[model samples]
Target: MSNDQAEPETRPCGLTPKGLERQKRILDAARDVFIEQGYDNASINDIMCRAGGSLSTLYRLFGNKLGLFEAMMTQTSNRVFSAFEAVECAIKRQETPEQALKRYGHLMLERVLSPEAVGLYRLVAMDCSSERERIQSLFYEQGPKRINDKLGAYLQSQVEQGNMRIRDTEMAAYQFMEMVKGNFQLRSLMGIEISEAERELAVEQAVELFLYGATCR
Candidate 1:
């Protein structure tokens, strides 16, 4: 479809199992295309070719290329953050705040520093489209913002339990996430190899530092 074409007014919802599977296939193909070719260079036709779906179906499901990218990001973010459910369970079981944070930190590092995640970040970062703002917003809302909100909720729980002292759980969450990431994300985007030992060390240090600051005195 042309860039100027109006996006479909209605998007697919509550699809049958088959339809959902097909949609997943299309989204997976779109993710691969966007990551390999970057946003501007990627095309709907190319994605359809890889996904083996009709052009009309793709448009009906995703609305447009941007819509498809947004869906793909949302799916990917959900997958990555689903692992954090364990952290919540740990908290409910009265695990120490340090243990909970460390679990979150390790999971965050494993997912965020992944090649696919870094590729998606680079795709959004390097996008030069008229819809760049929308793309960036979608990525932030689906990815980083979700991560911060989850971690913030966890931190708030600790504060309520008198395990930590945080005036702004939101900011504290953002800070802790940044600390966990450190230079690894940048290095990954730049194609630098981060060893398993380095990732472990980074998470360990970040959790330690964050707990040191956040713990109730």
Candidate 2:
């Protein structure tokens, strides 16, 4: 293989001077192209033209359209997960499991209701048939799996503290998440309208149902 065809050697963590600027341009262009053209319709030439850069720059930076897509998926997922982690951190530092859980639920609802998340979810669902594994990887890495793991850690902590009765914290965490997200996700997937008032009401009710249980006191 020619030197140009060989894989790029790793550079420093920071991008080289020209690389940084071109990378930003490519990302911005890619986002517009993807949004405008959707998944299958967009082309590398179109993206290159939008970015005003040669095809080589696109290849060197992202490999191809799917690489660019994976980058976009990672970026969007990271933002949501960062929000999740912040809530988890706050919850972990709390005095009680109930408080931690409530805070986490609230943050989760806020994120799910956000436009960025809604758009991303819709996009993933739409592309699932054609890009099954890629979409699944994105969802698994940044969605329910991570959330359940964090919740399980919290539940285990509670168990260790003798604050709750639980045979399996992982199961408990998964159940809690299912209770919390089940309705909203279903509605969102169906394109049903979820007003702000309804979202707040649903979140509060779900949290209450999970912690207090449905059995009469």
Candidate 3:
């Protein structure tokens, strides 16, 4: 074999278990760093320092700071919408609509009201750079839109099962989410933790209101 036949360099994508763990550390640190310092003020060096990795490694894995930020956001979005993955299973298991919705609403609120989510939302909203639209678009595509699609599918399934009457599942899906959220989530962004009892009441009321609209008249 000719010496020019050089060995293929191992690409440093965090696909393996070890690589995935390393990527997780970087993402976790990046999340905190970005939250502490807005995107404009945030730096790759700071993320690398917190993540205990070299800048070259970060660059090799993610094209730039923006790419890394997107990756971090995607990870967070995946986590936030993870509970929805079980919706189909729960429905198949014959769980009551209220039971399924209560669990989903609780998880959704928990994620939406979390400090990190609030911080991320603020970061995206405050960002006015050229890449702002790209970032916001990716944020929604990877996060909210994904959750909405899954929820819409679940609602459509219920409608077919003779349990509800919904003209537009998509509209109803967002309506339920909005009704459950309301101003409480906005207050959460301002660092106000509404009482647990209050949140429960809101969720219960939202679910009841939604059911009333969905049930056959």
Candidate 4:
């Protein structure tokens, strides 16, 4: 093959099932390494050691450590946001907005405050170097931005159905998310234990407060 030609293995759509599996393995290993070692201390070699893949393959697939990190963030965000898919379906089922928001709030609290997610958030927080700005931006775009957009779409649907009166669904989505998170997310990231009852109460209160402002009044 010519140097100018793209390699089939490196092309995203060209990857076979085995190649896709290997890619997943590498991403999983990267996630573990990043969480354990932080961004600056993590090495491509360490990830390759855990993933059991050749360096050339890893380089070909992700280009560099930053690329691998971006891909991992994207993958993780996809998994996190997938849980909210039920929100869309809830609309189809004609569930009340309260029911939908409560379900969404609970799921968001659980997923966003998970150990892995908290560790990743700390990993990003600890890095403040100029070179890591891209990593930070990628994290926001892949994680928070995507999350807000998903919930914003759900809120937009509610507004269309006249169940809510939000003029800006995006801002409403962000506010509702913050309400659900409350101080519990901060406590989780600080290694403080948050009881299940506390989480449930937070979600219930968030939904109530959100509806008071958002519902047709």
Candidate 5:
């Protein structure tokens, strides 16, 4: 093909590649600083020094301190949603409601027990007094409410197929999730990491309770 007829090829410029890497480095450093010092105490200088980048890049990439925090929050939201999406995809492929529910529970337990999630929860707890509204909104937007919505849809499908008897699926989903999260997650937020054995016990217990309640007679 002639140059005029050839399709244009995309190429990564040096600055573009370096800039993307720089942004990732900044985010990683910021996460570490936030984990160590919590949100209110973490400073831009600390992040920059740990990131091994300059002020100009930080400002250009994330604007300011609050902007950086918002960026981190957005990243966390995406990470959680990505996990949810993976569970949903697995559910779709399995074509079995019971298996889907089991996979969903395991995926959620994994996400909730992650170190970054633990740090974020701790940061929110510390900021709740002054940042109550933001924290509350983030919880609903990125966590419980979304998960409940997905579970409700899944339960409705199971009911339609006569695999489960789900009356008031939304409420059922909420109750089931509360049972799953009631104490373990609260302890996780308080920085008490549940050991492997404890997590396994919780998962098995939750699965048993859910299957007992939802199984068709």
Candidate 6:
């Protein structure tokens, strides 16, 4: 299945503008196929057919089915990380912790509960168990872990400035993220649609509670 696969942890490493565009087209098409067919049932040919690209490009760019899926995960991770960077900058600007938390929480919730995200989660749930280690590793290394690292860095900054007291920023990030979601994400992932107002209220309350628990004297 290996064609021109890069290291497990890298992507978009060498794609040119035109190449990136083609790759994106392939990815968008693949996403549709994966969402429609789920992982196991989906195939590169289907993707190629839908993408209007050759198998060579997919193999050359992604390597194989797993690589393609990881690329999908990568896209989602990149989107979230972009948002995290904004939050990081806002926090660095000395925005109120509550305000920053609300912004971050809202963005995170929106991304995780998106239609595409839910579809990916459902696809993985339906059929990625046998390769859980590979898929989970890909997802974690690029998605959750990256966000956690961003959050940990931000929290460490706050702690250094005496804005918060956290023994472990990593754990704090995990706790805060979980608290932000609570049962909301679980319900959303299960096909329960949460309203925008409800999402905002939940995150607002969660951030207040999170700050109360983490704020310094």
Number of the top candidate by TM-score?
1
In the range 15-110, model 2's lDDT, one tens digit per residue, is 788888888777777766765666666677887788887876666777666777777666666776666665457544765766777777777777
List TM-score per model, in order.
0.91, 0.79, 0.86, 0.89, 0.76, 0.85
In TM-score terms, candidate 5 sits at 0.76
What's the lDDT for all of these models? 0.85, 0.70, 0.79, 0.84, 0.71, 0.77
* lDDT of candidate 5 over 39-79, digit per residue (tens): 66777888888899777667766666666766777777677
Backbone clash pairs for candidate 4 read none
lDDT of 6 by residue, 135-215 (tens): 767766876677777778888888998999899988998888888878876797677889888888889888878887546
The stretch of ten residues in a row with the least summed lDDT in candidate 1 is 1-10
lDDT of 2 at 15: 77
Q: Give the clashing pairs for model 2.
A: none
Residue 13 Cα positional deviation in candidate 5, in Å, after optimal superposition = 15
lDDT of 1 at 95: 85
| Residue lDDT tens for model 4, 36-148 | 99888888888889999787787788866777888999898887667877877887898888898888888888889988788888889888655488988988897777778
Report the alpha-carbon TM-score of model 6 versus the true structure.
Answer: 0.85
Q: Which parts of model 4 have CA positions greater than 4 angstroms off?
A: 1-13, 213-217
Q: Which has the higher lDDT value, candidate number 3 or candidate number 4? A: 4
Query: After superposition, which runs of candidate 1 have C-alpha atoms over 4 Å from their true positions?
Result: 1-6, 9-13, 213-217
Arranged by TM-score with the best first, the candidates are 1, 4, 3, 6, 2, 5
**Which stretches in model 3 have alpha-carbon errors above 4 Å?**
1-17, 213-217
